[model samples]
Target: MRPCPSPLRPLLLGVAFAAISPTALLAQQTAPIVLDEITLQAATATGTIAAPAQPYAGGQVSTRTRLGALGDVDVQSAPFRAAAYTEELIRNQQARTLADVTRNDPSVRQDAPAFSERDSFFIRGFSVPNLDTLYDGLPYIANPRRSALEGIGRVDLLMGPTALANGGVGRVGGTINMIPKRAEDQDLTRVTTGIASDSQLWTHVDLGRRFGPRKEWGVRGNLSWRGGDTALDNNNAEVGVAALGLDYRGDALRATLDLNASKQDLDAPTSLFNAAAPGVPIPDAPDGDINTANPFEFHDSTHRMIAGRVEYDLAPATTVYGAFGASRYREDFLTSNYTITAPNGDAINELGFNPQEIEGRTAEIGLRTEATTGPVRHRITLSAAYALNRNNRGEFNPRLLGFPVAGTNIYDPVYLPAAPDLSGLPRADGLIPFADLRSRSVALSDTMSLDDDRVQLTFGGRWQEIRTRGFNTRPGIPDFPVGEQNYLYEDSAFTPAIAASWRIRDGLTVYGNYVEALTEGPMAPSVAENAGELFPAVVNRQREVGLKYDLGTVTLGASLFEIRQPNGITDPASNVFSLSGQQRNRGLELSAAGAPMEGLRILGGVTLMDAELRRTQDGAFDGNDVPGVPRTAASLYAEYDLPSVQGLTLNGRVMHGGSTWYDQANTQKVSGWTRLDLGARYAVEAQGREIELRANVENVLDESYWASSARGFLAAGAPRTYAVSASMKF
Candidate 1:
């Protein structure tokens, strides 16, 4: 048994603060000269984006990634599959959140829009919450509902269960990790402003600099604000984001600190609850510009986080590191649920107001070292982690007054009157205990290489303990009194993982891995008799094999994977919900990213899925395709710089999805749809730097269709929108 690493929260914060305090007094955000193409190329060509290897051919992504205990390894060389999208890509795409930037990944999809209150998704046909996302390789720090992208340097996505890397129960579908930006060798002063859709306007400022004699201290900061009416009628949104990053790098010591805060407000938000009433036939989707929620309805969320890390090299081949993070999230919404009841667009709308708050903290300490034997080289790591989250909720909504329901039409939603003030209810502004989660883990692993490093094999295991407590919950129609309640659930497991990789030849590698994850049980729906009941934790497993090829200018990857998962389901006869359902997703994924040819760059992929139910209510739905799991999904986004026209580039993207069943019984399905988007950009020299103007038209044809039927819920697609922006570098 391996001993746990002591908590380093205090030491990590102290070291980082102490290292950057002196340099902060002398740092200059702006240098004398502007940033030019040559300087930009030199800055990126170095190790600014990735380690050892420069940015890939297209400069949109890097082949190297920071895998949990594995440290940094080549994507192809690592047994698991993953990709790290670069800041260059984020800037080009104008991505506002993780969902906006990850659209290029076929394995990842979301039912919500970028302007929505939450950012959630399905990676490999399994649900993933934004709260599980990581910041700087540590969890419980990123925003709980929506992750901001202002200070993010790279978005790394690892496909499949990563319990072996991130100890304790982890995401079974995948993991998204945001790498923070730091001051680069070259100074930067960039200002960008834009307008979107009918009346939205926004501006952003970015600054970076290095200080001290050896330029070992660095600082980077970003701030942005946006607000206006959107393409959807009656829908208005506003957002503010701020992020600051500090770091220090020496010959043997390195430390970093990151701080972020953001707030978002939305009125008459669309597509939050788009489910059709049971036994009601699916209705035709309204126009893209339609806003289903009433104009008086509103939703708002706020997030704040601070994190720090420090690492020191004890020897050339050995190192010690520690990380700590804390975050707070609060949400308030006076929204209503609208359910379609008939094909004629008739629906029932009910108003419900609830406020939620979540607080989380995580810390870790680890040691890594490398040793060699006569015939092999070994890299070993031992680490320990602790994470805790406490969730609280308000009891002002239905507990005191039953929310009333009204009839409406989906095609032409009748605006409702204003909601009553919430300040009157006692404790309406206060919060009651809802749920708490704590996870403690110790992990150790080793990677061995032989035969000139051509063949490699890795194996590891983690001992993890998960403790959960539950309190108050909103039950069925007639609300129950909200009171102090606490329920405790604890479990422990030893999860093992193994992988093997063979470099068949230069620029090509084949790898496979087997992994498992323990996931929190789903809450029973309000319609079930066991409403709000939490099922016992279940283990999810996956098996994957993949092949990779670097075509110099273009890189292509292919993989086949299988996942088995269990969930809670309601029994119609017994009216009880329990962990009696199982699902298996078997699929093949093909992806390509980079500059395949001169004057061109591409990033997109295709996914084919065979998701089916293995066990269901009394085996009634056995062999049926899993609801909302599309048979095929494909997207392609490409850019071409016209050889005849200098400083001009045109790009277009097309997304297509196959049909999917909407219910477990597979009685009906929503047809697939295709969308097209176009954009252009022009760059010219200005003040010794560069100035770029960009424009884009999304949903070119103004197609109106069901965006997603995930979990049997139907969310309508957003309308066509136009955006244009200009950026200047100094």
Candidate 2:
């Protein structure tokens, strides 16, 4: 039972105010229209501004999320489905952090980790390694870092086949591009402070300025710092991020240069617990509790990135755009007291020492152009890229301490005595430090519009080649025993899309589109020394059909999609050292967003999915559900503003996720759960400036469930939480 501000009173007062305000002002009165009105109308008609370009067809949500929209589409009139997490949305939602903002988007999901170092997420059912993340259109080559979502100007999430343009390195679900805040006219500064459920204090600041005669070239920057400890006894986190950018937009050409840097340190102390044996009932404590008796591991680490882009208009109708980005990352990671369950259901303990350091660099360059020649419209784009990554690991072993009870911090190291009792202890005899890889790709695409401009068609493809070389510092390391390992792998695939739109009536346009896209080749094998090592890549092919309806104030869409990954390479069930074969994901989605009624805004979406593994070395899994992928998911958000009040609004939302499997065996399952959130805001005028106050509560039902399950571990979901914030604008 959650209580929200009553909804009916605002509507009634709003209507009455709308009816009376105008007349009351008229009574106090003004001058009548005269000869001046005629001249004003004529001048206004001749000096009208051109509309912004239509955004390309498809969904684009982030600046770093490389979908065709970022470089190809006009942002003015194209009918594509997109949800921008703009500053206004962030403020209205009272989203205090980055993770908080993602909770509102139906297509994106975050899997909370019991231990902070376990890795967080902003994705759809895909194993996107943390190393693949990007910042301001550049890959963060260093260790990934988490930042406050508040300082972001906007976040773009481009969905579907648009993946083809991003060098094809992710899940088909979608891509996220976070556009940080840039400088604007007038000096602006903001400070935010908050507290989490774990009783940790958090604060961040953002500043922007545009000084000079015309403010043509401006400066923008942000600084965020946060530190806190969790309910889990030994866990804690510290993070800091700073960014600055310069912008110059002249009459004919525009350019921007920016720099971003961040550092994160986490004392992610985590405890490991084994589920009770098959015959024993699973233990259940109070609704929301952390397991503190288990022996734990502690993790400490740091990450950084530097990057920039330039755009020039060659002519009134033609423009050339190019971008160059480079980044480097270095990290030293270590783990202690790692534990796992043995086959017999007993707990096995090991000291996990990962005293390894990794450093790598990623670079890319690309060009784009578009123009219209009479009845024929053409768009052309070409890109060339090079990337290299290297990892050096040495003197690490995975056996050491005893496993403790749940949630506890206890260490019991294993020792070998005079008689050599080292049966289960890790051996330090064979250690290696070596693995380097390099890859390059070239892509070209052209889209032509014909048939009276109502019918549009596009055909594009990419040719990519990858070369790898690996070496081991130690002998007997399987594939590269005391020598260099080299391999050359190449792949070429074409992405073709066809879409059409018809103007059925005024203010209404209907459209449909179909796209065939593909992801690149295989991935590097895990760095585990072993035998019968098999490395194979996976291919994803998808076909989708959807309908979109737009009527100015409202937009509606529905899509049905099927994706098949033939020869999907995966780790073998028997050992984590080898690989195995195919999987498929098929689904349907429906969504709508708009201001259906005056002063009211709404966004709703639902998805029905079927994901599975078709075949494997173990046997045929034709009907088994894919692990970690939801069968059904839904979300809804609605807000209403009171017209009578200068600034007052109410907001509410609900999100739900259906059942999902936890592993390939399909023996463990997580049931569905629903969440509710509610909030409101009020504005006050003080000393000629306006200030807004907001309050919100999440998970009103206080439901307890597994928010995310991965590899073989599960993280508990957060319980009910409430927050309040205040902001001022000048």
Candidate 3:
């Protein structure tokens, strides 16, 4: 932790107080503005001004989390489990993307590792699409593949299906929400320069200011650039980002706006989806530093978005809020299909090219009111949300027109050149119909308190509707019809939730909840006989119980949960896809965060999970463990200050992922693995400026292994990496 800056810090005791306070408005009223002047001007300044929950004791996690239409909820009082990685920790760790920040959670794992250029993840043993992430409480604004960490204030993770949380539902796994940064009350200008192992260089600038008589209007902006070769062989990467944030904090009204654009290009991109020849033993992982991609293989993506939100207090205890967001993601890739054939690493490769564009718009409005009726007090909320998404792709569909297969060796790979005169093939010009999706939902909830508010029970439900349609991009292919071969699915479902919490004593709370999530059904894979088939919407269920204890400077928590979801798979014998599968995951989680002592801080947790494929075709895989769901995953991150050195601190982290099967028959397996990371930072005041120097090394042991094998696709882990940077504030 750094010292308070300015000495005359803003009188921002809390967001609620600041909202109605004449001096400081907190969403312009919600967040805590406790940083002193100099500290406030630090490089990690956020763009948003509203935070209902302050950072917990350790400054790495928050005490409150967003609970769907319920809005910001105190952790102890909330029946769900969640984690929010703070901005302060992001800067110290030199995170580059969403995956880097979310690795702190034991229940979350990326299905694709570093260099994959995409950010899909597995939460509680279920696959989560990259397209379903939320930005500032709105769906579809974040980049579909990977969202940059620049200007992001917090990366929030809510485990379990959250269909009731938004119009676009994620898989039964979970949801990830990103909060954009807002301006601080104090004027700030901070710049950072850094370099990574091999040959990567980057720089970032953050600026914030407040204008208006009462400093109610504010602006924050960020610009960043990174380019050069990455740690992997033959990989060259380039990226650029620009972002701006604006806000207003008024006595009864508060608002914020954000605009962002970013682009990434990578040559010799890594492939995360590798298939093993049927009935063949999977090969051991190759050296992590080698490049298996051909010279011609590359990927390019661009992201652009604009989002805004506002709130108004009708009275002291009633508030109305609304939010809207729109975003676009453009993606193009020259890729291939790789299938490992032998244990010695022989593989076959076939080229595939794809180019696509996705766009989305979302909006939500709600009213929250607090009231009293006799001995019971009540908090009620009513909300409605809508989202629209459209996708465009090239005319060529790899599912129907795959290239002739070639050969390669995983141990000593071969790079093949692209065929000349590719005029007849599909290109990244994005000109054909792919899919369009529309979603709408309405929700209402009431929380009633009893017995002096010591015990509370709440019930809520959401009525959601989904309309989706997909078109055959390659109508010319003989396998498809002449006109657009169309597929459409329209459905509606109601998801209900009930939760109870009891504050047994000061700083201690116990809670239980039962929730249901409704989501769009799965689509048949290209390899299946029923390619492009769309299924009806499905509903998932979850039951959980938990407790939290706070010891002033420290906080500890534990929870047990069970979730059941409908699964879809292709019949091995018939090559047909169907929703004839089901999976249930039950887990126990323990977490801790805070500064147990004056100079030492710690954050981490452990998750023990039992995931089973309850029903499969002919019971072929019944009672078997689900692929990629580790039995035991544990992680710990700690920081300590040396009394001998006033402004210096050292930190380290250890992570372990338990062994698990990679196939349905419990055939292919990935061994358990452990990783270590170390870092340090120094802070000092010089020439009227606060300066910080930070350095970190990930995978200190340089271990090479498989990270995940969800959906029968193998994802390789990353190798050792080193990074260093310096930040200066003025």
- Most accurate candidate by lDDT: 3
After TM-score superposition, what is the CA distance of residue 137 in candidate 1 from its true location, in Å? Answer: 1.3
Candidate with the greatest TM-score versus the true structure: 3
Ranked by lDDT, the better of candidates 1 and 2 is: 1
Model 1 misplacement above 4 A: 1-53, 274-279, 396-400, 426-429, 473-483, 525-531, 569-578
Tens digits of lDDT, candidate 3, 1-730: 1122212122211222322232321111333223242111111111123533588887988877766567777666676777878888888888988888888888888888588778888888888877888888788788888888888878888888776555435678789988888777788887677778776767777888989998889888987777778888888877777889898998778899999998888888788544553456667777777777887777888889999988887765667888999998888777666777777888887666768888999998888776666566677888899988888877765655545577888778887666434567655454676778788999888888788778898988889898888887765656665337477888888889888999999989898889898787777865566766778888899999999898988888899999998877655446577887788899999998899999899988999999999878789889999877899998889999879999999999998889888667787777778899999998877657677778899889998778887766777788898888777777
In model 1, which range of ten residues has the least summed lDDT?
A: 38-47
lDDT tens per residue, model 1, 276-304: 53445577678889877878777787888
**RMSD in order of candidates:** 9.9, 11.1, 9.4
Q: Give candidate 3's total backbone clashes.
A: 17
Tell me how far the alpha carbon of residue 28 in candidate 1 is from the true structure, in angstroms, after superposition.
20
Query: Is candidate 1 or 3 superior in TM-score?
Result: 3
> lDDT score, residue 411, model 2?
25
Better of 1 and 2 by TM-score: 1
